[model samples]
Target: MAGGITEMGEPYSPYVGLVYMFNLIVGTGALTMPKAFATAGWAVSLALICILAFMSYMTTTFVIEAMAAANAQLRWKRREQEAVKDSDSSDYSDDEVIVRGRSEPLEARPILSVQRGGSSPDQFDIVERVEMGQMASLFFNKVGVNMFYICLIVYLYGDLAIYAAAVPMSLMEVACGNHSCSAGSVKYNDTDLCWGSVKRKDAYRVFLTIFTLLLGPFTFFNAQKTKYLQILTSVMRWIAFSMMIILALIRIGKGEGQGRPPAASFSGIPNLFGVCVYSFMCQHSLPSLVTPISDKRRVGRLVLADYALILAFYSLLSFTAIFCFAGGDLRDMYTLTFTDSCHALDAAPLRYFLGLFPVFTISTNFPIIAVTLRNNWKSLFHRDGGTYPWVVDRVAFPLITLVPPVVVAFCTHNLESLVGITGAYAGTGIQYIVPASLVLLSRRHLEPALGRGAVNKHRSPFRHTFWVGFVLAWATFCLMFVTANIVLTETKPKN
Candidate 1:
């Protein structure tokens, strides 16, 4: 089948999707995992990360299933409209042909389900591109859609905030802080002066201003991260990762390793959960990523394989860092470890390269993410067939997208807390709860029309109702646990 690959020019091979997913799932969040890993204890971090990865994978399948269902929903809705407009041209055979060719067949034959029988022809047929917002409209009630928008908005805002803070923090660390590998173990306070008179906090704020001035305006225009840019980012990411992993391995081989992470630390599990969930996040973009694959009959298997590779990759990357650097020695930004004291490496150029990795990568992504948030804002307020006012479209939307994150970044440059908060709450909603609910409701909405036996070609592996309940329940518990942890930690007396 030609499917929905036409608009995107040439579709990529299945392996390309594998690579795209890996890159998407392993971003800034991975940089923070080692610290959480060290703090939480190696054993806890390892076990928890594995469990979270599995949970995230499960929800990811939920999203893909929902995306296919959404596509079917859109396809049938359009047909309904067409049928109304051309009532006189209706033919009974046309309905059957469309049903047989495009609609979910009356019996579900999941591609991954263990079956000895032949598969249905239309089982893999919902090939239209349906974004999460469009799916919300089709599947969720008004309140549910609004809640989704709000949750997504919060998540996007947190993302932009984290990005806005990260670039400047890296710049400030590079420009004003001590670079002598000797004092790498000591923590620097924000009140410390830079350039003789400028405080480190002030330096961070200055860089944030510069960051906003330079990249913030991209939010005003409609933009897409091109394939070339993605490739470039991916290359840089691998180079940076390889550099750190190799450096750490060399240090450990030389008996110079500083880290002795404990086997398990219960206290550190919460932050690790947030960071891992954030790192594994790719569900929100599933519709865009999955729909354009050249061959998707095995999309579920493809995603499962991707998640497996990603889990192994993350474990390798984080474990290497935690062992190479002491728990207290690891910085929230893992790149800072290489920069703090470059004596570990003799090459000055390589030292600078490691220190500034986040600056380059995060800077590139900041604008792209800002534009995504801006688009989400527009979608939330959007009316059908309605055009936005000049101020609302051009000015207000971009401002809304660009400001909150900047303000949050301005107040603090703590990358760990920012990532933690974003992932724990908004990330939970987007990655877990929303996907589960969407699939459940989509199944319900689709069943009456497609019938009880209808098979969603892309239905989640957890096709049972209990799995949806489990996901939602887990999300709720995480939210409560994270919230309680934050409150207790903040309110406790300092000894």
Candidate 2:
């Protein structure tokens, strides 16, 4: 209300760090991190984390610089204004011309006179403001923004479809266990705790298939209303984090047994890196933090503090997970994996908790993907008159949101595969590539200012180094993961 409503009549509200963090977690981390580590090995995962973090930091700095430049330009122009007094007491005098020329309308006369009077001596202000505004526009408009929107659509729909199918499948597997009609015989490995079903082992495969087919539209619709959806997401994240911690502790205390195989062999270096990346990917929430810290100087400080806290949280969780499941199967790497494998009958509470975590995370994320898609579609077609206005505001939004989940329900009707694919791609783009590119672009454009030491010293070289290195490395990692996923998916035998 304070900021007033826009022409579209929507109220403006500033973003907060918590919201951004929630967005990052639900949109990408919740669904992907577990699977990413599983696929890329810990080392590659860790490399991805470092790269993503660096890129995110860089992007944030650029955003701040861009804002500052624009503001500075405004301030300079405002200061250069020359107050004009009426030379003739009459309102209709030459000095008070209602319209300057035949080509100019009455409304344009004042603005033209102000410029013609040459009231502002500081031309830098105009230049800076123009440049900064253009920069901001570029970030928010342009093909880059469209790319982000498309990426989000792909990620969300893909994930939602997979999860919709995977959840049911995973749940059924856990529920049926030895008594499952599909499972004729159940064999459990000692160290790995891997379970094999002789009959109907492919029961869940149906869900996977359904998930893959419905992924496109489901993700597109889900990405639209990410901003408000984050509130629910935050709660889910904390719950997941808690479940993970408890599961880790339980595994570490009780040795793996009862058909559980040894933890997937950690490629030591790769695993470590993977864990780090998983943790760092959470930092994509940093931008939401920017809006709250109005002062530029304080923004740098806040970012540092935020990163410190993030690192500490990630380190604790990764360490706990690694130590607890030291010799377990990496394929089933989740907070519930330990409980499912070792204490199946006994660890009811942990399993239930873990089960609940995905439900919340997935539900929240589903809406986000839908919202993102709807908004982007509206921006492109509705604004151009290519589509009816009511289509976006009324028909399209609800249809996009509801249709995907329904289709997902018909497909594999599970959440696992949906989460997996969404996590890998959407998570990677939002967390790594977008931020990295923004930083790179900012650095290139603002190089002169940075070189002149015009930026606040405390936020210079160290920050720049982190971002530049981060963008490059993270981009590489994301590309690799995407390629690997495409190759793996394509090469796999079809059911």
Candidate 3:
């Protein structure tokens, strides 16, 4: 019964867990996807997204299997500690000796057949949130764990940089560009004047500075979003997304659509691959999301349902966008596309709301992400039973987390490139490579204690050893292709 409650202080339901996973997977990446879809072309984009969705679902199951294994391992260790205590006590008797018998090194013990038919409590019920970091420690060597943390940290930095650039870019556009429907046809450059003398780029920096000063300090202290605030943001996200989709459909229906995209574009595949990978990410946070579910028996179905719904939503959004607007007109941030004075939307108030939406939503997330990164930094270097100095603990870790992303944001406001690089490299590790490694290693770690036949009710459908090798192999291919694409793009002669 205690396992029914989540760390968020709410009683768990399968439906609630579904909502959390949905929200986690569909964030900033979804906003950037329409532009990538347009560039990549609609036919290829649809097929590729479906494939990515299935791959992502497979990895999701892998993470859930790893979580159950981690839980079982934790329970096994606690039993061992209790046995040692009982053996050391002077009043230990028959009952205590029976308990001590279970403490024999796992290799010498008989194979404990899987529990079933209501004979005993299952040892693998997920009751505790064993974070990916803790799972890494349990299953990986020192080098592996360090590599995991480094990949995670780099991904977080990319996330922070994208947020930093997006907010200011939105502000600069709203402040400098004409909002009247008459000037919607015009496009402005960074060199254009915001007021009289101030350039658009300069205005962007001013807003970025203000944003950093206002929200950056929260990183030094622990910060988390309250439940109500999360609910409010989720509501805003749905409203904004719905408004864009409806407007695009209305324009297409009116026979005013201007889009004429190609059927396929080979050059666009690498960026689209990164965007899809980023959009489907939830593996790293599955422990926090899945452990609290009251009924995990149907969790595999819940994940399937969520992914189906999300894939449909993405298809609808991207299809409407590419059919409604010309490829060149689509902005990297899809919300900004709605803000333009184009025929799709003309209401000043609604346009402004859509344009500034990222500012409202991403600001709330930046502090939470900053704190997460800071904690990961501390975890990477932490020593058993050793304490950090006050300045090192309170000041230094947060500074390292806060500075790098902000500096990257300051240099370029090109969000597409940022998201692409982040998702392609570090995101690949977190989503594909890390989950595969975790499940593989966790199974080996638990086999001696639980025995090979012990059932993990939450084991992945992709249970074959071949699937694990396949995921790692796919991750390697993606990284190499993306890196080569980047190099080729940079070296190609400019026209």
Candidate 4:
């Protein structure tokens, strides 16, 4: 019974199961997928689906190996410490005969039984020492710890910025049709309402400000505890998933063509696919998944399950969005698609249900951004404590996470641009580059342990190397695209 309870505490429960599902859907797919599909089109979107799924699986495998290495190192260090302690207390029995007397004869009695008083104390010392040295020289140095930290920072920043924009956008959509706000100016009912009158830009600014100032702090404080943090993260994940689902469905049913601007170039398909890939880019959270599953076999199974679910979700959403909005001027992506179909006066209970997902997504993502900033600040200063107290940390964390996003909201406040920037840079790095690097590095050093036909049974050396190069090249190209797109499409003049 104790063992059963212990197992429950070790991250194998219904809650974790739901949390993983929610994380995959909301963390990557729900938040950024719409934008990817909007830019990349269905074909590229399909390619992204395959790539992201493969990357996710590879990342999971490497993470398991890294965790196993870390655990082994820790065990080795503890054993060494024990050995050193015993060595310090070493003593020898004074009365023990160095050798039996010659008169006793060769086999007559216990000969030369020089008692060390207790055990040799250094019996396992050599084993412990060797293991510790091997761990430090091999595992710790080679793993992409630094790269993960950098990628996490970038990803979280993008997430916070997008959410900061999205929350106000959602609310503005809600407030425009509310009866009390409308007053007696023009008793506009649901049927009579149009998208023109909504103060979308203003609402977006308000949302951005609130997220930066208010939600940022709240999330920061809550994230201190792992349990609550996980729960909050899980809730946000589901919210993001629901948002993507709703947005995709709305785009499908509405059939595009809502008087929004047309695509500036013939790159919508690429952009859309990028967004789809972004939706499944949950590499930052992969470590959390691996930490829970102890058994190597079980880890493989869980990762496979995660990939299957992600593939199914991405495929369905991409297909529906493309078929529904085909040739209908892919301008403003699905934002216009959503706004056109659901008037301010129309009580979209479905949207409200979906709205919960984005709310959690935006809220949680903001703090993660803040935390990343804090971490970077600490690293630069070589500080031992948290970065909460440092002025540079405070300024950088909030400013990077919030200010540009709020300003963007106040200006153009276009969801497509927000999502595009996020996918192009942050998504590319987090989802593609970092994972590929980790896999390659891990395979290089721990080849025998993580190699095919080995104890762990990972991918072949050639296949692993190919993926590493492939993902890095793809990510680099996306980075270039992001730079070009931003240059070409500067925010429209602020009112």
Give residue 123's lDDT in candidate 4 (0 to 100).
Answer: 24
Q: What are the TM-scores, per candidate, against the unseen true structure?
A: 0.89, 0.60, 0.93, 0.66
TM-score of 2: 0.60
lDDT of each: 0.79, 0.46, 0.85, 0.49
lDDT pick, better of 1 and 3: 3
Q: Native-vs-model 3 lDDT?
A: 0.85
Candidates 1 and 2, the one with greater lDDT = 1
What are the per-residue Cα lDDT tens digits for candidate 1 across 65-178? 887776665555565556444533545332332333464332342322212133343643646666787778788899998899899889989898888988888888788756
Global fold similarity of model 3 (TM-score): 0.93
lDDT of 3 at 283: 85
* Candidate 4 local lDDT, residue 128: 17
lDDT of 4 by residue, 106-127 (tens): 2332311222332222221111
Itemize residue pairs with steric clashes in candidate 1.
108-455, 181-341, 259-326
| Best candidate, lDDT | 3
Poorly placed runs, candidate 4 (over 4 Å) = 1-9, 13-22, 28-39, 84-148, 177-199, 219-266, 294-296, 325-348, 351-357, 384-412, 443-454, 457-466, 477-495
Per-residue CA lDDT of model 3 for 57-126, tens digit only, reads 9999998898888778777777666655555573544333333344334334333323223222377778
Error of 2 at 183 (Å): 14
lDDT at residue 366 of model 1 (Cα atoms): 82
Off by over 4 Å in 2: 1-48, 63-136, 139-142, 162-240, 254-288, 294-296, 326-333, 342-347, 384-393, 397-428, 436-495
Order the candidates by TM-score, highest first: 3, 1, 4, 2
Higher-TM-score candidate of 1 and 2: 1
